[model samples]
Structure formats: structure tokens, C-alpha cells
Target: MKRSTKITMVVSAAVVTGLLVLALPAMIGATTWVTGVFGAGSGSPAATEPPNPTADPASDDGLVDLGDGISVPAGGPGECTSTAHISTMSTRTDDSGPYYSKLIGDLVDRGPSELASGQALTDEAGGVYAYEVAAGDSAIAIGERFCIDYITVQSHNHVRAGMIHAGNILYLRPDPTLPWVSPYEPFDVQPGEQTGPYYDAIDFMRNAVVAQDLAEAQRVWAGLGPHIHPDARTIATRALEAGDWELLRQMFP
Candidate 1:
């Protein structure tokens, strides 16, 4: 064969091979990613894999272990017997007299003052803290509790000090509204100057508690107990009176 013809054939073959390699990926569709056990065939039911073993609370870190704390099973309510007239009524109001009504009125009026004093108590103990903030939290108090500066929290969440509500999550870093040069550094604030938001947040929480929105109220009240005005004792009292163990646990635990 002529050298030129041989060279031409070799070059054609090389170009065809390169084109095939590039087209191979496009020719085959992307592979499907199947999670868990796939069926043996199209008509077969999915093969059942053994369930993941549940972790024992006693063996888990951060879990309350038996002997360390009483374990309540995750099922139904435990034994709580009420007294006569109602097996669970811890104390019966004497319906035969107007005296009990006055006592109830007095209890209602005294709640806010108690919550205010409760805040002072927490301050004294140095336990004010914030775990998370949804839009419902007092942005100012959250900033104070997490040691995030107030101005930054307000700007990041896009609310004035008093506008935050129950479900706003503020990003500590990369929130362009603050003067913080480094996002990771810890900081603290004096409580009273930026408390309007905190007060408003608590007021909303009080209403929720009164409305029997215990879980919602507890969520709002979760970490702000120290910040709660002693007057909140009224709210707490309502929670206690209503026998809401979960809310009470959040408050006093």
C-alpha cells in the first residue's frame, strides 16, 4: 500500500475512536440511584432488609440512662390518680363559696410581677441562654442570650428589636447587617437596654399559654425563663394549674 493511503486510513480510525469515546456517555443515560433493597425482578416486591436496631437510651451519649434518671416509656401516660369528685383533681375549689373566686382573681393579677422577678433570679444565676430562634423569638433577647450583638441579630433576621416572633432562625455568620468583623467570636450584652422584644415575645407566649397552645408556648418560653418577668409566674401558674407536664418541665427543668 502507498504510505500516504496507509497514513490517511490510520488518521480516520483515530478520529472515529475519539468521537466514540466522547459520545459514549451521551449514548447511555445516567444510572438510576436506588436506595435500600431493590426488587429481585420488575414484578417482585422489594426485598425487605432487617430493620436498624433501635439505640438503647442508656448507652447513648446525652441520653438519660436508667439509674441516672427515671425513664418514662415513650408510650401512654403513667399513673396519676386524682382525688374524690375527680380522681385527678389535686385540689378542689370550694364551689359553695365566693371566697375561691377572689383567690383565683388574685392569682391571675399576680402573674406578671412574678415572671419579672424570675428574670432577675436567672440573671443572678448567670443562666440566660438561647438555643435557637424562629421568627417568634425576641430578636434582641436572642442576640443577648446567644451573645450575638443585638444590632446584628435584628439586621440578619430583618426585624426591629421587637418584631421577631416564633420561628426565625438567624444565621450568626454572613449576616451582612452587623459590624462584627469575625463571625465566630463570642460576645455578651447587658439585659435591659434591648428588652422590648423580649417583653413582647413573652407577652405573645403568655397568650398562647392561655389559649391552651402549650407546645407552642413552651417552644417560645424554652430558653427565656430567666428573661421571663417574674410576672410570668402567672403564666407559669396557669401551666401548673392546667397540669401541663411538658410545659412545666421546660419551665422548671
Candidate 2:
């Protein structure tokens, strides 16, 4: 893991802990929008701190890929729900547990505890990349450690350009295809500081419109706008091309 990513991971653990403690109840009481499986969003800078191996358990199974092509490892499950909602999920669960019960170490564990375990960082597709940043670590350095492009890492994680911290978890995975891209292409973006829940909103719009489920699209787009990237454009262009002005106006307007 890269230093920046590690720092992000450590901060993510603390944030999840705090969120579960503070925000879980409100979410449970409300509609509890499904955000985790969608997009990324902003949060405090505290999450950019790197992990301390002595303080953080370096070897644990803190990751579980949701098979929807989204991987939720312990550290950077950005903007997720405190309570799990299985019924609405489109992916199979590899592990299930309450947020509070999960330990800080177990949740942030990247691989196994020892090289002898055969689950060492070397076992990963790319060798385990690790870094340590104090007050001086550049955002570019952090991005390099994690093997993510500077922009994608920064934008997706909601960080300022060229800013990061120390003791972070900078784990890397080969870039995967974004779920909503192929059609939207180059315009896939979140307006403002939008995050996970917004992606759910986008997904809802996508299903309703592209899937030819007009009612569903209408239901979700009730609050959408022209500024919404890619999808809004894709949907509008398709609607206009097909002479479905009603759908285009409803979605883009």
C-alpha cells in the first residue's frame, strides 16, 4: 500500500468508527439511501492520516469484494452505510457483520500477518507499495504510491490537489472499469462534492432511462439537473436522437 492510501485507510477506519457511532441511527430511521456501492464523496482531512503497523494490525482480512465489481476493503469504503441493507444489494456478500463489532485492526488489515502465511503483500498483483508521509508528503507522492492517477485518486477520494498526510494506507488495485462509463464516456463525474448516495441516485436514473424503465427513471430524476455529468447528457442525447423529447426534457431539464 502507498503511504497516501494507507493514510486514507487509517483515516477511513476512524471515520467509519465515528460514523457508525454517530450517524448509524439517523440513517436507520431515514430512507437509508444505498450509497456505498455507488460513487465517492468528500469528508474531513483527518482520514488522510497513514497507518502505523504497530498501532494498526498489518495482517488481517479487512476486505470483501461485493462481486458487483466493487471492492470494499476495510480502509476506504468511502461514504458507506453503517447498517447493511441486503435486499437492495445487487452483489453477493462475501462477509457480513455489524459495523461496531468489527475491530480497527481487522477492518484495516491489508493482507496476512506474516510472509509465512502466503498472503503477504507480495502475493498481490503489484508488489505491496508502502509509504510514510508526515506534514510534507506531496499529493503526487501519495498518488504514485497507490498506483492511481493523480486526478482519479484525488477526485474520487475528495482530496485537494497535492495534499495528503502520514501513516496512511495506500493500497493499490489495478484500475477496474467504472460501472457507469462505457456509454457516458469521459463525462462520468459528480457535481459539487457529491459522493456515494449520489451514485445511487445516478444508478436509479440509469436503470429507469437506459433500461427503458421510464417510471423508475422519472422517479429518480425528480431531483436531477442538467449539470449532472455524462448520464444526464447521454440520456438527453439518446432521447433527442430517438425523438423522445419528453424523456430528454424530463431528464435534462
Structural similarity to truth (TM-score) of each candidate: 0.20, 0.21
Q: Candidate 1's residue-wise lDDT over 40-117, tens digit each?
A: 211111112112223455333232222211222222222212110000000113211110000000000011121121
Q: CA RMSD for every model?
A: 30.8, 19.1
True-structure Cα RMSD, model 2: 19.1
Model 2 misplacement above 4 A: 1-126, 129-135, 143-149, 167-171, 174-253
Q: What is the lDDT of residue 121 in candidate 1?
A: 12
- For candidate 1, which ten residues in a row score worst on lDDT? 100-109
Residue-level error in angstroms, candidate 2, position 85: 34
Tens digits of per-residue lDDT for model 2, 42-145: 11111122223332332354445432122344554333223221011101122121111111111122222221112212112222322233445555444333
